[model samples]
Target: MRSAITLEPVVVTAPMQTSPLRVVLDPKRPYQPVPASDGADFLKSIPGFDTIRKGGSNGDPVFRGMVGSRLNILVDGGQIGGGCPSRMDPPTAYIAPELFDKVTLIKGPETVTWGPGNSAGTVLFDRTFTRYEKPSWSFIGSLLGGTRGRFDQTADIRAGTPDFYMGVSANHTRADDYEDGSGHRVHSSYERWNTDVTLGWTPGKDTRVELTAGRGNGHAAYAFSGMDGVQFLRQSLALHFVQENLSETFTKLDVRAYYNSVDHVMDNYTLRRPDPDSAMPMAMASEPARQTRGGRVAGTFDWGDAVELVAGIDGSGNTHTSRSGGPEGSIMGYYRDMPRRRDATISTVGGFSQLTWYLNTHQRLIGGTRVDWAHVRGYALTGDGDSGSLSMGSGMGMGGSAPETTAASRSATLPSGFLRYEHDLADTHATLYAGIGHVERFPDYWEMFGGHVASTVTSFQSLRPERTTQLDVGVQYQTQRTQAWVSAYAGVVNDYILIHYLDGNGAASNVNARIMGGEAGVVRAIGSHWKGNATVAYAWGQNQTEHRPLPQLPPLDVKLGLVYDAGRWSAGALWRVDSAQHRIAIGEGNIVGDDLGPTGGFGVFSVNGSMRLSQEFTLSAGVDNLFDKTYAESVNAISKELQGYTGAIRINEPGRTFWAKLEVKL
Candidate 1:
């Protein structure tokens, strides 16, 4: 693809090791808030990023046209399970933006470095270790409060020398139930804190190694769903190595390994379960607890300016057990987690190569391929719940069934490809570029046994996978008077799996469907100190054979932001809008549950500002939903109204809130 060249060639691409599409932080950038409360939360500001609101917490992030397991998220290169299986905490909840120096997103089928099965794409969040010429130290902090009892704080301290470095950071946030534009009180109280430490060593001019660890906890009352969060925990560790410009042939080499664990607790009676009269059904508030643990290792080699290769391996396991009147009053039951081995194991090995050719400087070509082999074998002690067996592709013409014994094995090989072209013009400061990509992903566990069940199917019939082939293209133009870029894409998803929910009993099943979408963003830099970014996106899905709109396809959305910046201070305002969704499936929905009819259209405004405190420190703050807008993002089963059970349950997004953050360099 050829992009209209800009006056200035922005060289912001990430290193070969973590290839995230680069995001520049121009303090004045509107819509873009400082480090977000969580990974997904921060993503909301991105043009095509949206969250399905349940209540105060646990919003699932949707990108391009994919959500849930289709998108792969990694922390320092480690693939970890999202905390809430029901997604109360969502994977992004465990992250603190203050801890990462860079955030990168690879849109579309992922490369081998991030493991596999990410048809939606891969996101990489990382913290870099900056070296110092001599022993030095610095500190940064932030404070904020606004409309709905909103308040937040963050701090970071760093010390380092030419040969060694150490750094640590902590953050906290809270908000009272918010009042919407219509003067409606929305459920929305959330508070959380996290601390992380990193130590690094630079043994030579081109070599470096680092170790990092962190822990966090929090809870939120959902507004969209019926449940309130009782408790959540996150712990992780990571190790990294970097070698640069190793030789004329190899530009760099990177290797990393890491581990992550989530311990979660919930109850319906604790917050505001609707049914308080349930005598026997009343859980002790802590009857349920679930945990997942796992780790991964990967290596990358950058071949000068032409080729790059990444390879990795990973594994994980999950276990869940509940007790009657146990921890918090959740449900009346007593069952310490059973010895879990299978439900807790997911192992994968993969490799990918990317190539770039300077087809005569004025012209260039890019092509790459990736492959991954994953073996998943897990067993859950479902007890007497019709525990039958494994089915590979039950609903589709895939493959299938195996006895639901202690040992069940399923292996899948995924392949992906990409190609692109760029042309430079000597007549003007401009270039043009275009590209296409195809990717296939294995079905996730949630897609497996969580919903549908079949009698006689293929080997491991429940695990039937899906494949996709797509094409994307864009144009960028820059002139003394204007700077703009537009990208569009269309794809056909074959065997797209979707969960169908019949009612409140969580009896869900799967159906293969199709989906399509398009997105575009443009920035116009009027003049010195005046700038704006505008984006619009729309996505659609249909069960062509079934002749119905696919479930949970995000509504059409648009974003606009204006910003002003100076040497040390910056300010901005952002507006977000969405078209009313009238095409929703209200019948026997499966996997993702209710399409909950039509979602009303809504608009929200946000404002933010920042100041440089010194040569080494900076401060920033912002207020979201400035007008305290009230709306539901998307509906999922976990978001069921919890008015009766008087305990912790899953819900949706909170109301208007504020946030602040600070950073320092030494």
Candidate 2:
């Protein structure tokens, strides 16, 4: 094993960013969110990042050109479930921005540094303890408000010395129905809260021990779903130890163990008051919850001169359970969770290692692989042992294990690998790089129970793993007044997972689609105080065999922005235009939302400003959907409509609004 070495990208990773604002969700940079919605919602402000729109919150982001299980999302090293089955409660929604220190995103399948099947790269939201050269204290806070009675508040405080440290943080967020371009009020409302605490000890110069505990809960209304104000509750605890500056031969060492539990509830009992004509048929409720508890141990080593290696293992099992007796219109006891709640603890274990070598001053290479082993056990749910939704195909508490099909009574092994090469230009600040990768992902819970077909990757197999073989290449350049990057990739996927659906005959159908495309972006600093960023991307994938455009392939799009940063103040403007997308299928979807519906091209504009008030305090604010454009990112459900669109395409965006943030360091 070698010592741990620093590996950081020169520029920040964003979703085909056509704006100067970097992706705040990326773990490498520190981002403070004052908005009161789930974390992923904040990401939509970036270019090339869109969602399966249903009018309101809980929209799952599609980055670059990948979505669903293709993207690996983790928080404080924990894998949290996205509460909304249609992804209204994306994993980021379950996390509070005030709880963590930084967010990181690695775009594309250029590396295999994270866990299993992240063919779309990895996203990590991390937390780090505060350290002081001497005894010190600090506070960070933010407030936000917008149209439709929207508002949010957050606060974090930390105090400590080199020998001992402690910190705490919390937040509250709420919103009401909003009107789209058509002046139609949307029922997108939610309320959430979070709190965290950590105590640390620095016994000597290079060692530290820490203990952590926290709890969070919230409820939200969805225009895309039939229910409202679904409840979200969670509690978690963790223990960690760290040792740095060990020796030149062993640069750094770290170990962490954690246990977390979530008690989520979804019901119309809170927001849906009995209104005869308001689409209320009695009531809908579900208290289903998914609980996942696990622990991990990892280490990093750096080999002197030219090599660095990282290896570690993690294991965790999750289970789902619920009980409900309600009206036919009510999906009571139907708590939406990752991998539909069955009476079983699906367990997974995996290990990984990566080695980077400096072949020469002009070249480098990274090679690594990861293997995951999982055991899934579940039984059918027969409605209090009396009658059941078996006829509805929703019973998940009775079926026995498929021993012969699974590797270990209910388990299987997954593996992925990657390789890369790079070179720097002579007498210039530029680099050219390319790589090839092979990645595989075991079917996710949504891809299983949520899927109407027997298999997504195979003809009849039950959710066979999705595999992708990709080739990636790109270039970057920087000058005193200009910066630019152009990335292009092409890959042929085997068993490419595609979706299918129908609504009358003209409703678009995504037959067997194979997808392939590329993205490009650039920013030039104009003369003295002006900076401009622009990007254009086009992707097309389809059931190559079916000869149809891939369902939901991002349409031809363009983004442009201008920024002026000077001393303690920065101001910027953002504008985006997207071509209409007619390609779509009604059903094939991941847990959150699905398919393409009819859409017309539209444009949106926004403005933002930030200022450093003092050495210790900084303030920032921005207005999203500046022009209050009305558009549907994509359909949440083709067979139905969220709130109302006459048909199924729900094209609703927020009206003109304002948001603000404040940060303090002491």
Model 1, poorest ten-residue lDDT window? 9-18
Task: List per-prediction Cα lDDT, in the order shown.
Answer: 0.58, 0.61
Cα lDDT of model 1 by residue, 1-666, tens digit? 943222121111011111122233321111243234566766666556676655444566777656767778877777656533355656777776655666676666524446566667777777667668788887765555555665667777888888999988887877666554556565666777888989999877688889988888888776544346666677878778888777765556777666677765555555654444432133333323334455554455555555555545555555533332333232323323322222424555666666667767577777767776766654532323433432111111111342344445577887877787767667775566666767767666555443233222232445456777666565555666555555556667776765544333333233456656666666666677766777787877777656787766678988787777664677777787888887676653433345767777888777777777765556667777777676556544444444322342323233455665554545
lDDT of 1 at 89: 59
Q: What RMSD, rounded to one decimal, does every model reach? A: 7.2, 7.0
CA lDDT for candidate 1 = 0.58
- Top TM-score: which candidate number? 2
| lDDT assessment of candidate 2 | 0.61
The regions of model 2 sitting more than 4 angstroms off are 1-36, 83-86, 245-248, 274-280, 326-341, 381-409, 451-461, 499-513, 566-568, 616-619, 635-641
lDDT of 2 by residue, 187-280 (tens): 7777788888989998776788888888888777667655554567777787888787787756667676776666655554567554444333
**Model 1 spans with C-alpha error above 4 angstroms:** 1-35, 224-226, 272-274, 277-280, 284-344, 381-407, 425-431, 451-460, 478-482, 505-512, 564-571, 588-593, 607-623, 626-628, 634-638, 642-666
